[model samples]
Target: MLELRLAQGNLLKKVLEPIKDLVNDANFDCTPTCLSLQGHTPMAFVVLSLRAEGFEHYKCDRNISMGMNLTYMAKMLKCADNDDIITIKADDDESDKVHFVFENPNQSKISDLEMNLMDIDSERLGIPEGEHHATVRMPSAEFSRICKDLSSIGDTVEISVTEEGLKFSTTGEFASANIICKHNTKVEKAEEATIIEMNKAVSLPFALRYMNSFIKATPLSNTVTISLSSEFPLMVQYDIAEMGYIRFYLASKIEEAEYEQ
Candidate 1:
């Protein structure tokens, strides 16, 4: 048996919005201390971690993995109001369906939905720990806007980072553009500041489509952290207040000329 209650139901909604776009089905692995999901496509990989303490109520009889279609779950979540309290219940031993309950703050309204679970076979990928060449922390809204604007100009973006700052560059048939954000700690709010830590300079090209898809998580956090290294995939992370974080990883694109060599 397992159950979890979250006062801020919108967080789950926001988490699912981007995931459904990238992955169709996934397993939600729940343990006593945490609930995590990892899904990926050929172009991008995503990992979501939510700590059990973040929930108002959390219970688990044993570790279990519940497989379901993300799009279907997102649709059910859409019926809930932002202020609604959400409770999820599942039986590890007996049930093939997961139950979701939504209740208004006043307790004047309540709704329940159940969706069938699947037996999905998936293995969690182990992400190795390594230092990034450049780590940039900036406002989430700023990153979203940059991806959206760059997508309009080109399908790929060259991200370059130096001691000075971070730069996003793109080129189209008609024109090319570049946007640079400098490091600055002087801000009214820390979340609004652009901070960069660079161990070495690195420039890599990535698909803008995946970047835009990752931007759907902008609503979950005020600040976004981007880590880039020549040896690893680009990582964009959004930390959820005190709950946990969602991370998206995309591999850099190699030029045709480089491939020929």
Candidate 2:
């Protein structure tokens, strides 16, 4: 039996929050070193992949595949006791190694396990497969502010990018909002290109909802990455900690009469 006590609760929250929004019963195929979890939502599904070079006291390269129940993982992490020994059911087929047991109490921990994982559902995980016309990463806080600003004036937010800069605008039956990118607020980087290509504007409501979760993790960075295209999904990535990041993808929702007529 492998036994361990870890304290990195926030890390668990970061990993589960975005995934909960995508899948209901997530299967964590975990070994001692790597983890890969993926599920499908109606609109899109996200695959979380992670790796650790060395784990626990004894350094032994052991390959073990364990299918953990989400509900069990949820309850264990939700009301985690200080001495909770996370037990894993081993494969009867493989030989046991003394190094398979991981013991380290100095891990991480967090409060809201539910909040850590975003809205878990089937509908929100769908993503249309196609070649994206454009992609760019931006400051998540800046993008979140832009969404809130444009949302105050109207129900819809229109995002556009050009040679000049990126712009957020919204206009409905009566009100409207228009905001432009500034010199340092949002821009093109020397090492990386700024303002991902977009031939048209996407519906902002869903995009905002998706982004809200992206920045929920602690220790916010100075910037967030935003990638978009006319016919493909929009992707936002937040680098929260070392080797810990959250990537959110949202499909474009455009009314047929907007620009196709």
Local distance difference test scores for all models: 0.92, 0.49
Candidate 2 residues lying further than 4 Å off, grouped into runs, are 1-7, 31-33, 54-75, 80-132, 148-156, 172-174, 183-207, 217-222, 255-261
Best by TM-score: 1
RMSD of each: 2.0, 7.7
Clashing pairs in 1: none
Per-residue alpha-carbon lDDT of model 2 for 1-261, expressed as tens digits? 322222343355446655665545755445465555656444444555555432222122455333444554555555655343232233334333211112235535433221122222332233466755444555555666777666566655566666555667777677777787633424355323244555444334344454444445323445666666766656666664454455666555463234344
Given candidate 2, what's the lDDT at residue 150? Answer: 62
TM-scores of all candidate predictions against the true structure: 0.96, 0.59
